[model samples]
Structure formats: structure tokens, C-alpha cells
Target: MPSFLRWIACRAMLAACLAGIAASARAGCEPLTEDGHDYVACRFDPRSDALSLYWRGADGMPLATTERLADAVAATGRKLVFAMNAGMYDTALAPIGLYVENGRMLHRANLRNGAGNFHLKPNGVFYFGDGKAGVMETGRFLKARLNPAFATQSGPMLVIDGQIHPKLQPDGASEKVRNGVGVRDDGTVVFAISTEPVSFYAFARLFRDRLGTQNALFLDGSISTLYAPPLPPVGGWRSLGPMLGVTAGP
Candidate 1:
């Protein structure tokens, strides 16, 4: 074969391979049904994508909706690709536990016991810093003493170190719209939300068994929602506290 022809063939193959990779990276949320429930699972490579947390705007009020966030990012010449409520909040729409955005701590970690899911023991923190992402028990995270650029603390870890939370019953009666985040083996970030009511055990399995994430943290329930391209708008009665979003690079 001619050397020129061989070089052209090699270039074509390289281009095709690059196109395939781009297609996989662009694959976002998709419907996933399991255990008689509906869910939307979105996957992104954290190592390559830009992930950040948002709460208040210049006005010192929670952005609340994705539309507001989109507009805010647009003003900065960036595009918000996706976003979701990051954790539970109080009546005032403030994060109930640890909340950090852009390397600033907004709320300290909560370790006290109380009513509701946030108090559930073994709660954990989902965080990213130093170009890596992780989910660890709140106590373990505190003990490690590592500071993260973005962090959100929430309760009753769904999957811990490759094992589902012991407190999560296999067939519990209690169920609600739930959402959470997990980190895969390759450091990819996987976010999932139940479109229909689902038990904690089932939701955890989605992350552990299906998404292949060894450690996963529950973000919130009932008020859980996601905003991304091609997904219909989600209306809520109250404002959201902390939110996790992926944005386009400058």
C-alpha cells in the first residue's frame, strides 16, 4: 500500500474514534425502570466536565429554580448543562447540613440527631476538590480533614464502600421521589432521581448495582428534581437550598 494512502486511513480511523468518545460523553439522562419504579440517570466524567455548587445569587437569595441558574450562568458567558437540588434544607430554604460552594463554606456540618431523614445515622458528604470527587461518611470526612471546593452533606448514605446502607430495608413501605449522587470507579459522577416513588433500598441499588458506584449519598427526597436539556420543567412549591450543576467551559 502507498505510504500516503496509509496515512490517510490512519487519520480517518482516529477521527472516528474521537467522534465515538464525544458521543459517549454527551450521553446525559435517560429513563431507567427497575423494581416497578421509574428513574432518570445521568452520567458525566467529572475529570473532564466542570462541576460546581450554587446557592445564593448577587441578591443574597437562593437561585431556587434552574431557570434562574441558567440565566445567571449565561450572564457569565457559560452554559448550565444540568443541575439538581443537592441536599435537604430548612423552612427558610437554607441547607440543613454542610454546604460549600466555590470553596466557601456556607453551612457547617450537622451531626446532631433529630426527626426526618437528615438525622438518619451514617449520613455522608458528597464533595469534589483537587480535581477529584468522592462520597464519604460525615464523620469519616471530618476525620480525614480534607477541604473540598464543593461539598454537600446529607443523610443515610445509600451505598458505603461497595455495600448498601444496613439501615435500608430491602422492602420498606416508606417511599418517595428520591435523588442522589455517586462516584464510579473511573471517577465519573453519576446522578440519579426517581421520577416515581421508590424505596431507599431500591434507589441505592440503582447506584450500586446498576451505576457501578461503590459509594453513594442520598441528596434529598420528595422535593428531588433535576434540570437538564430535553427534560421537561419541574415546578416546586418552595425554593431549593444548595444545588449541584455542570457548566460549559469558558
Candidate 2:
């Protein structure tokens, strides 16, 4: 081939490669409804989208709201794209179970059983590092002894190894606003929250059936909320504990 023709072909290939990368990195949220309940579902590529866990601010207090987190991230020259309350917490806005951020372990994993969702047996941790993400039962996580760059321990895994939690009932009377995270087969991280109250069984189905995730961990309920852009901010009276957020790439 002529030199001129070879140069044009090389440029075309480079352009195509760049386009594929952009498509894989795209992230956003959308409204969804299931089982008569409303929800907001956001999908992101863990390998590309910038995912981070945040707790305390520079003032040594939890960044309770999305606005505060956004400002903090903005100061670092990156825009906060979306955020959601992650894991269960105590009255003082501290994570009830294991919480790790940027290699720092703020809280230790709780293995005992007690009241509330956090203590729900078989509670799991959602963790990510080295361009990979996953959800594992707390017991399994402890056994593996893997150290992640970011992690949050939350409970009563909605979907465990492709099976729904044994305690969840199809017609359970309990229902409340809930949010959770799941990793798809292709390494996409999906964050979903019920805009309206929903039962644990129903919410679990959303991850296993709708999202096709084999493992999903419930983040929180009642006060579960999300902060996705373009849609008005969602907030609650209770202050958040640990938060998971996605920020604009550098």
C-alpha cells in the first residue's frame, strides 16, 4: 500500500479504539419500576468509571449529604457524578460494620448476629480494587482475606451465589425504601434504589432477574437515597454514614 493510504488506515483504527473506550466508560442513571414500586437504576463500568467510597470530610465529620460530597470532590478538580448511601450505620453516622476507603480501615467487620439488618446473618461486603469489583458473604470474605482498596460491609445479601436470601419472603409485610449494589457478569456495577417502599424479596428479584447479578448486597433501607445528576437530588432526614460515589474521570 502507498504511504499515504497506510497513514489514513492507522488513524482510522486509532479513532475506532478511542470510541470503544468512551462507550465502555459511559455512566448514568434512569428511572425504573418493578412490582408496583418505583426505582432509580444506575449502571457503570467498574473498570472505567471512577468509583470511590467516602465517609469523613476534612472536618473529621461524615459527609452526610450529596451536596457536601460533591463540593469536596469538586475541590479535588473532579465533578461528582452520582452518590448513594452505602451500608448500615449508627446514630453517630458511623458505619455499623466493616468500612474501608483508600486502603484505610475505619471500621471492622461485625460477625455477630443481633437486631437490625446489619446483623442479619450472612451479611456481606461489597468491595473493589485493581480494576475489579465483587460482592461476597462476610464469612467468605473473611476466609479469603483479600484486601480491597474500597469496601463496605452491609447485610443480608439480597442475592447470594444466584440464590435469594432464605429469610426473604415473597409476601412479607415489611417494606421500606431500599438501595443496594450488584456486580454484573461483565464487571459493570449496578446501583439500584426503590423510590417507593419494597419488600426484600421483590428487591432481590430485581438484581437476580432484571439485572442478572449472581451476588447482590443490600446497602440500607428506610433512609436509603440516591444523588444522580439531571434528576433532582434525593435526601432524607437521617444523616448518611458511608457513601459510595462516582466521579468524573481525570
Candidate 3:
């Protein structure tokens, strides 16, 4: 073989080897962060292979989905109050959206924060919802089997056996993503990033599969933001959007 051809072959083999190594490393274990919060920013680990929940904080900051509850917890020192959407909004039962109400899943009033009569809230549990029984719902199919209930909505979703479950997919599809933030009854907030406008059906399915919650809903995406500390300019921890996430601690 010619010297030039031999060299080219060697380089191709090297590139192939590098690519394989990179892929292996990427799949070794789930990615996570621990700047302060108790969960990974954008990764979910599920107990069963059926569904799971995943999240990724800003590059260097935590997403501020629950800023309201976190602040209240630090200030008043009381059991907070929140509302839920369960992945359905409009009067027509259009996928669940967020609304703040205390004691009920679809409360729509928070005069202090200017969220009144609106179908959405700023900070609440953001996850997939069944769109059937509002918050505190069970999967359409899995209700008798896996019976999964989420504390919030912070991951994509999945649908199995004609039922919804909280699940995550790294490269699912553009239609499955929601460009918004979501609120849950328990106060968990999910900041979503979507390549396009997600709908009620798709959102519900993705939320169920990826996040393991049959009743996960959509949250503010695209313009969604996060904020955190110990930021780096060049590489390492960074926020997803312009908003900052500051955990309450002195």
C-alpha cells in the first residue's frame, strides 16, 4: 500500500477508536450536579426500567422553579401552599397547566404574586399529569399496577399500555418537548426546554414516560431561566437561561 494511503487508514482507525471511547464514557453512568440542590439539574434515575425523571440545572446555577416555596420556607417557616395543573389547562381539558390554589390541585389565586384567575403559576411542581383527575392522579393504565405519583414536574414523559408515566428520553423528539415552566401541587417546579411548542397530548405522554408521572404537565420553556453560584466563565457549571437560581442560605 502507498505511504499516503497507509497514513489515511491509520487516522481513520484512530478517529473511530476515539468516537467509541467517547460514546462509552457518555453512557457509563447518569450525569448529575451537586452545587447545592439535592437533585441533578437535568438527569433522572428511575427505580424501574419503565419510566424515570431527569433534570439539568443551569450551567452553573440551579433552576428557580420553586423559588417561591424556598423563599417562604426561609422566611415564614411554615408549611407552604401551592396549586397544580396536572398537564391540562384550558376549559376544554387542553393538557394540564399550572394554577395556584391551596388545598386543591387547581387553585388559581395568589394575589401576593399577581397570579389570579390565571391558569398558570410561576413556581409549583412541574411534571407530567394524567389530564384526567387533575393533581394527585394515577396513570390511566398503570393505576392498578405501578401506581406512580410525582412530587413535581421536572422531566419529560412516556406512555405505556395506554397509560401515562413519568419518564425521560435524551433524544426523544421535538414534538415531545414543552417550552415553559410547570407547577405541581406539592410545590416542585419544573423548568422545561423545548425545541418547538409542545401540545397537551404529546406533553402528557412525554411527561409520563420520562418523569414517571402519569399526570405531569408542561412548564415555561424557550425563555425559561435558572441561576446558581460558583459560576465559571469559560467551562463548567453555567445556567441555562438569563435567570439565576439562588438557594436560600445565609
Scored by lDDT, the top model is 2
Q: TM-score of predicted model 2?
A: 0.89
TM-score of each: 0.88, 0.89, 0.27
On a 0 to 100 scale, what is the lDDT of residue 129 in model 2? 80
Clashing pairs for predicted structure model 1, backbone only:
none
Which of the numbered candidates is closest to the native, going by highest TM-score?
Answer: 2
Q: Candidate 3, residue 16: CA error in Å?
A: 41
Give the worst 10-residue stretch by lDDT in candidate 2.
Answer: 19-28
Worst 10 residues of 1 by lDDT: 229-238
Candidates 1 and 3 compared by TM-score, better number? 1
Q: Show pairs that collide, candidate 2.
A: none
RMSD of each: 3.6, 3.7, 16.0
Give the per-residue lDDT of model 3 (tens digit) for 91-180.
332223223222233322222333321223222333232321223322322233222232332223323333544233334354422333
Which residue ranges in model 2 land beyond 4 Å of their true spot? 1-26, 236-238
